[model samples]
Target: MSDLQVGLISLGVVLILVVLVFNWWQDRRMRGRMREHFPETDRDPLMGDVTPAPGRREPGLHLAPASGDLPAEDAVDVDPNCEAVIDVTFAQPVPSDRLHAATQALRAVGSKAVRLFAKNDNGDHRAILREGESYASVQLAVLLANRSGPLTDIEWSQLWTMAQNLAERFDGSVEGPEQARVMARASQLDALCAGLDAQVGLALRLGGTRPVADVTRQVKDAGFMLHDGQLAWLSEAGMPRFVLLYDGVQVRDVQSDGVDRIDLLLDVPNSPADSQAFSRMASVGRDLA
Candidate 1:
């Protein structure tokens, strides 16, 4: 072959080898990250061609690097000691004037982990009404763990619902038909959540992948009715169950049609203690009143 022809052939071979090396390195890095985060799962990112996209960022908290430099068939171990614990207090029947007070109160305990609790009109703590802080943490962990791009609404909704359903289906130590009752109540709660006013200032505080805290400081600021007292605590199927307080008296056995969004009441046991508890957060009342 001529000298020019031989040089061209050599150049082509070098280019091919470079491309191959680059691809292999990228795959190794991607797999390393996934295994580090999900050590228990049997899935392999390399097998599925799951490449981390450009500019990937997780919401709420930063994720740690992959578990190790080697490719293992299993996931890495999670550091139990590193996990965070958030303490929340669900204070309710907050009026408008109490909004600032609640904020101030939340500020007093402000760490990234601590969340203040505010109640809805029915008087049951929203966090208690939903799943607990651990469930919320799992949700946060999922978000932080997912190093990919933004999840579509449907994607996020599906995951969120899955976590919730899983929590309901398996109630830790609780057993038997108790699982079914949880599902029914979740269905009912679903209907109630949809009717909540956007202005009510409802928000979730992300702890890991779960929303550990549900704050109603804004609802109190909006001047909605506030109640205190342990009304009714019913965990039945067919409707979203809540603690109910009526006429400043709490009752826990009332069930209502899934409509009327605004007037449906939660029946928790009522008392002067409930009233006093509700009034203490009066700053919320002032904002909404």
Candidate 2:
């Protein structure tokens, strides 16, 4: 090989070696930092003795209830059965407003709802922060399921990041259930909720296209009122019984020449159970048809 070509080949090999060494150094530094933050332990203090008792189902994903040192208000806002929780214990009492302000940005992680609860000097846990009260610790909870789906990995990571930041800001220690356990619980909760969720829809297909304004007028005349851009059939309590859309788009946003199809949907989960929701919705669908 020519001298120039040989030199280039040697240079390429040295660059590859340099990149590998740099990656190794970075990884080692990260590991060291992690070890400092999360030292090895014989057992997880949060999940004391995971061995299942005889003839009982294994424990579901949940952190042990806050000790006497934590807040009782957790029951009011955080449901352990359907939430992943992180507990932050401060070295000293902190002002409620300061902690509240720090957590405002963490009210939501992705689509999952996040809630914060603090334990005041009176030993009561409260969701609402009292400006003059001081709190010793706080609990953060992320809902695992909703209409959208289960809590995803990205959302979990975001929650963890927020919790870590809170701990650093307050000079506190962070404790939480293992991520694997939390994720398993989330999937289970999502499945249970999905089984109970129900939505009914009916489509009306016209013989010919009709102007948007004309259809909207007829719908309004039929007692459907505009709500959040969609046509809604409201109950005596002013709650939506059925929502109407034109070709799957909001009635107000349909920009087509005309609308040939419209759909009516009843979300059972949000409807009042005593209303004979399905029967009434079916009757409405039949009448509309």
Candidate 3:
């Protein structure tokens, strides 16, 4: 054989050996890490006994415990009656009384996922409450927290916890924590009666009489760009109609009877708007309805 040919063969042999050694070393490192985090799972068939898949990059992928293993924190002693603290707040005099009374009313109505708390602040009545798990819930919390009445720390804590839990549960999924709370608050408004003693008007306004506003607020709060306007009937037989707008466009019209049903009228164009007239019409319809 020629001297040049022999030299080329030697170089090829050395390169192949280097690749083999590097792959072996990498496999060993991955297997070591996987073994530290997981004990019961089977090893990948193609990889070494302790190694994960070659290209896996998911965060905490190797850190998962056995599928059914409870978190270690569960082993610690805990109060059976202890509830998760959600939020805290302070409320003023008349609102505090109203909140306390409203809480009693909510209990009487057998409301689920609703709570109310009240306290005296140096002779001023104060209160706080939590409604549910969506946007309506936080809106209610905000309204309660922002009202003219005195509020207490306890109420604020409950509301905050409720919001945080909802966010954690449904944050990235459709209809997240903000939406859940908002929906709940809207339902509460649907249940409100005409002759209710307190400022029912303001509550209805702040809580929103229709789902479109609640949904719109939630979409905005979730960092989504608004695209459509909505108006709807919040009452059965269209007794109480409401309108909702987004980005200067009408999206829905809602009407409902004080009974069991509400209807939503949506304004979706077949194509994007061209003239300003269509935009104006949608806006006017939303405001007027």
Candidate 4:
């Protein structure tokens, strides 16, 4: 071996070692920063020690932690903790076209589905009333959970203003619950969600060499309706009681042929979380299995 060739080889080995050491230092620095910012703990202190007033959120922050350990019920944020639905009733039946326009206006204020219902002879609100049908009376239902954490004065005023506009268009009156009553209801609901196992998730591991198509078929037959990637089960009230999410698992080995695996995740939120919900989810999973 030539001395020049041996020197070149030594330089390459030293350079490789330098690169590895640099990466190690970078990794340690990152770990230190992470520990400083987010300590390893079961309970998160950022959620708050006391629930704030309705519509009050710490400024400059928008996100509310969905699932975590709460020391107490009052520790949860009132705004994001509660969900609500409000209704606006008109004096006379509004034509389908007018209702559509009013819905568009409502959408501008808060971008969410505006449900319209018409009363039957028994005074039961029946959903899916045609926009063209003009009845003696109709109701508009607004969901406050989608846009804001809980009911806020701004949101309530927007809804009230829209109701006024809707009433003016139909030349009718607007009737609904008091704003204070709605806020009180929100607090009650948040407390209930806090007590209940608000969030529960179960994972089904598909380890067999079965095709993804077949796995999906079996899940569908299990009575789960596929929407996007989530297989959802809806309550009688038309709310999603639980959801089965599809997540692909990692294959340890790479061969000429790849293995297919679908992770079936069962996610249940406290919207109506109860023992019954958990029981129903377990039963469904067992049936699917």
Candidate 5:
């Protein structure tokens, strides 16, 4: 080979080696950071094996033991729980004296996915207990998202352990749905969420003629309420059925003479997966168009 060609080949090899070394260093640094956040714990057989999968990026909750001990809250998983709606009722009514401790314990224990609810005398269910007030009975709708989707055997055990602790401390007797029933419902919900697909939108051509404020006015005039940075078209009972959002394109696109659009997204996961809801949303989109 010519001297120049040989020199070029050597340079290419050096560049490739440099890239490999840099990648290795980066990976090492990331592992160190992760360890700092999630300290090494006694490997639990219940967690199964962490096999590497191509293009897979889900975080697994490493348990300390097969005995249902929970991990640190800071290292808690961020994925949506498989069972977003767990019905938690007490076996025995919580007495007035232990009400504060019960509420605080329920609130403090478990990951963010856990939410406690109770019904008032008027038959309205709500989270966050009233101050200086006591609940006759309580319910928990713990979000099962941290363990990633469907509840594993280990995850279920951890949940039961947490529930038992709360019940023991307070006068509450933790009542959860039957294991088979809970698993079946959670599986169905996960399947629906996986197959969810519905988005309706409309583009209002301002024709570079009217001001951007007119766009907002037109949406409001259509009887859609805007609040908390979300636009919702509510039902007769004031419950938000779907969301109406202003579509954003390039920053310059919204500027003078740029195209503007709006969308009505019916999040199927949040709503019922029935033909009726889809039909209503489709009708709304058709009308807007």
Candidate 6:
């Protein structure tokens, strides 16, 4: 090999080594800075005392409490008929603060909502866990069905796993209905929802394409406000009673060219029941026409 060629190869190798060493040193320095900023501690600032207290009684579980069993102020909005519930009893009464901190990450499993209720010494279940109070048991309720659809096996498993983990953490025991029963209930609930789910829409077609901005201005003037990219007609409670779409797309997505048609939709399940929903929609449709 030529001496010049060997020297050039040696230079390239040395440069590569230098780059690697520099990167390693930079990473180490950044890690040191992070450690200084966040020093390791035996007790967590959020959740203190990882160990369970001594002389805790054995955990147990039971069926969900009836609505009448809970006080009005502490009642949760969960429906026992349409929810998969798990009862968890701790080996010892756990502080509300610790329970709240532990459950911060367990609000939902996929599309299904999970609700927690704590039980006090009086056997009263409360949705809001009060600070400084200790709870003997808790109920975890997962909604079986919603607009998204029925809870699947994966979601059920996730709930079970989460419950099991929570039980282990608090030296507790969890009991819930069989997976098959939960799945069957979820299916029935979904079918019932499917029968009642309804959406009414009216289309306004123009003689020719018109500027989207002009149409939006007219809509806004007529008391429709932009919400989440779509134009919505809200009720007095600030809830959307109807939504407007431009050419099957969100009103905010229309740009450059005008639209030939606009669709007004009323989601029946979401609208207020006493608002004369259909009658009001028909009246609006006539006016728009």
- The candidate with the higher lDDT, 3 or 6, is 6
Q: For residues 64-168, what per-residue lDDT tens digits would candidate 3 score against the true structure? A: 223334332222221112111232232222232233332332221111233332222332211222121011111122222111222233444445554444334
Q: Tens digits of per-residue lDDT for model 6 on 1-289?
A: 9999999999999999999999779667655654454345444332344455478422222223344444445644457888888888899988777787777777778988887777865566767766556788887789999988999999989989988999999999999999999999999999998998788776767657889888888878877897776789888888887888888777767665798997888887777643355455545544454
Which pairs clash in the backbone of model 2? Answer: none
Q: Determine the backbone clash count of candidate 5.
A: 3
lDDT of 1 by residue, 88-155 (tens): 22222233233322233222111112122323344333222121211112211112111122223343
- Which segments of model 6 are wrong by more than 4 Å? 1-73, 200-265, 270-284, 287-289
Model 4 misplacement above 4 A? 1-92, 107-114, 120-125, 144-148, 197-289
**Where is the poorest 10-residue window by lDDT in model 6?**
56-65
Question: Quick one: RMSD of model 6?
Answer: 25.5
Candidate 4 weakest lDDT stretch, 10 residues: 57-66
Candidate 4 lDDT tens digits, 232-288? 776776556676654533222223243344333334343443335555665565445
Better of 2 and 5 by lDDT: 2
Global lDDT for candidate 5? Answer: 0.51
Q: List clash counts for every candidate, in order.
A: 59, 0, 61, 1, 3, 0
The C-alpha stretches of model 3 lying farther than 4 A from their native spots are: 41-289
Please identify which of the two predictions, 2 or 3, would achieve the higher TM-score against the true structure. 2
Q: Please list the C-alpha lDDT of all candidates, in the order they appear.
A: 0.30, 0.75, 0.33, 0.51, 0.51, 0.75
Candidate 4 lDDT for residue 216: 56
The true-versus-predicted C-alpha distance at residue 123 of model 3, in Å, is 44
Which candidate order results from sorting by TM-score in descending order? 6, 2, 4, 5, 1, 3
